[model samples]
Target: MIDLSFPLREKVALVTGGGSGIGRATARMFAQRGAVVAVAGLDEAPLLQVAEEIVAAGGQALPIVMDVTSEDAIASGIACLADRFGKLDILHSNAAQTGEMQEDGLIAAMDADFWDRTFSINLRGSMLCAKHAIPLLLASGGGSIIFTGSGKGLAGDLDYPAYGTTKAALLGLSRYIATQYGKQGVRSNVVVVGLAMTEALDRNMPEAAQKLMTEHNLVDHLGRPEDIAEVVAFLASDQSRYITGAAIVADGGFTSHSAVYADMLRFAAMDTGAKA
Candidate 1:
């Protein structure tokens, strides 16, 4: 019941890890909707490339080089953006690192260094961004902050404890932000990404694990970055004005096992008065 077109005009957005993958797609989408986008990433090449594309499309964009794990870099980057844009409206924290592979066991066997690095980028990075971006967003009369998540949050994938833990934590973080700042006119939400075809997919997966990805989805094909982007744009816009403290699963129905779940629930509750 809202006008979705150009809902983000005059808004300024920042997409971290915007060099590639879901972050890049989301930055493009925001620019397409007439928002001034700041593309941030540790790698300047991909970040600049995305910004250039947005500019070529007759959209406004600025490329920023930042290391999310470094609080000083994050603070300086936000300062630069604030100086240029005057205010911040949307912050999409999407940067992350894929932890070390598991050879013979679950994540418990995974390297401790990998776990530490994973959390630093995935969890601490988001917190750092939120810390630096909050003031300007508040000055902009409140805005939306969108976290990039994964289906791993809903269910732990074998051998990926680091990734699963971080994604699941992201949901809780977003919820707290939403709960605490709802009255300030700020919104916080997450896009629970399905298996998307990004570089991260091919590099980290083997033949068998990759096959499992396709079977996991209800849709015929695997999820794409754009699929997640569409949802991100919606949450970043006025269209989702009433949505906050929520995690929208955009996984091509990967989690839509309602019938199977219902039967399981009935079985569980059968012993008691309630159905499982």
Candidate 2:
């Protein structure tokens, strides 16, 4: 019989930016799959809330207030997990700074601080998490390190230069980690995130932009935090044991097609007289 369940029984996971959005979803899913989770982030309240929710559901979890950009904070948070769980089987790096949507302008017009801030959080933060978590994961005999990426990282965008640049850097970082430690049973991969209707997006994303995204997406609607969370859980589990140093696009096919997809659909509708 084929075992369809992806069980993470007795595994321990640490998730950065676990307060909300993709991080929170991932943490919850890990718990559901039998993993003990440490939800770490800059905010204490949200982390506490997540931990309470997991425990209330009869799962193991701990809230750790952490700032990923700080090496000391990352180390401390990992140490906390070690003291509590003894070893780590997964590290999900999901924190990111969008940078100044206004200040992360063209190369000539971009602000130095904006670039630095974005890199500090998205790039350096991910590095710190891996650096600190690998030893613990190694102690566990093997584990997964899943870093979050974005479509902006894979493609060029006119805006958010810093955000895109930092995200692109994460893909390279994953490959390096996978190459250096794959023989030792450590796996690293990048999960390229798509447009999701999170609280932040609902407040910030324009209605027109959402409609345009839906038109281009292979699926009828945009992605969700849960969508990215499931992919992260798979990579973290033994189900993806052989998958390493890969960029898995869980974007509902947002980046799978050409920019002219909508235009082609329009033409097809005109010729065939069929609604697309």
Candidate 3:
């Protein structure tokens, strides 16, 4: 009996930063497919909303208010989930904050405090989540670990200092995890997302920035959170059993061209500034 559906019927998925953005999307998708879902985020309000939505539609989910940077919080939340669900089959390390999504900053110009906070949330946060979740995954006879990366990760775009660097490092982390744990039956991968119409994008980018994104992408339509969730679900499921150490770029031809023109446009802003 080969079932071709997105079969997550008995699996348990732990999604960090699941309150909103790609995290929220993944949580709902996992629930829909029958995973006993655990959503962790700094805020509980939206986490509750996601859980409630899943519950309303006849799915199981547990919402946990936790911090990605705090080891204790991560350990506690994961321990709790493992206790309730008996095992962890999927770990979605997707928690990060871009400090309101800053858009203009060269490396030397970036604040020291901002740099630390950025890596702490993006890189260290993922590691922290992975550290606690790995044992349970190994206990369940291996599973999948998915990290949310970005287009800026593959390039050095001075548009944002900390965000770009941390994201870039995440791929390295993902590769390491995949290599080290493959023999142990665990698989790791990354999703390098392009511009998506998520809450993060809405809060961080300006209208002009959004306009520029739409113009640059091959797909004129902005990607929705659901788009990313679908990919995550696929990776988490056994259907992708053979895929590992892959940085799946989900950008709609945005990075397909491979030139980060984000910096060149800075001169145009400077030119306008000079005229004034």
Q: What TM-score against the true fold does each predicted structure earn?
A: 0.87, 0.94, 0.89
Which pairs of residues collide in candidate 2?
none
Candidate closer to the true structure by lDDT (higher is better), 1 or 2 = 2
Candidate 1 has a TM-score of 0.87
> Where does candidate 3 have its weakest 10-residue lDDT segment?
258-267
Query: What is the alpha-carbon lDDT for the whole of candidate 2?
Result: 0.91
Tens-digit lDDT string for candidate 3 (150-184): 99888777587678889999999999999999999
Off by over 4 Å in 2: 1-6, 271-276
Tens-digit lDDT track of model 2 for 106-195 = 999777877888899999999989999999888889899999999999989888778989999999999999999999999999999888
Clashes of each: 5, 0, 0
Order the candidates by TM-score, highest first — what do you get?
2, 3, 1
For model 1, how does the per-residue alpha-carbon lDDT over 1-276 read when each residue is reduced to its tens digit?
Answer: 444677789999999999998999999999988899999999898988999999999999999999999999999999999889889999999999853445313755677777888899999999889888877878888999999998777885565778778999999999999988889888999999888888777786687876665665667778889889999999999888999999999987878775365356556678676532
Candidate 3 clash pair list: none
The 0-to-1 C-alpha lDDT of every candidate, in the order given, reads 0.86, 0.91, 0.87
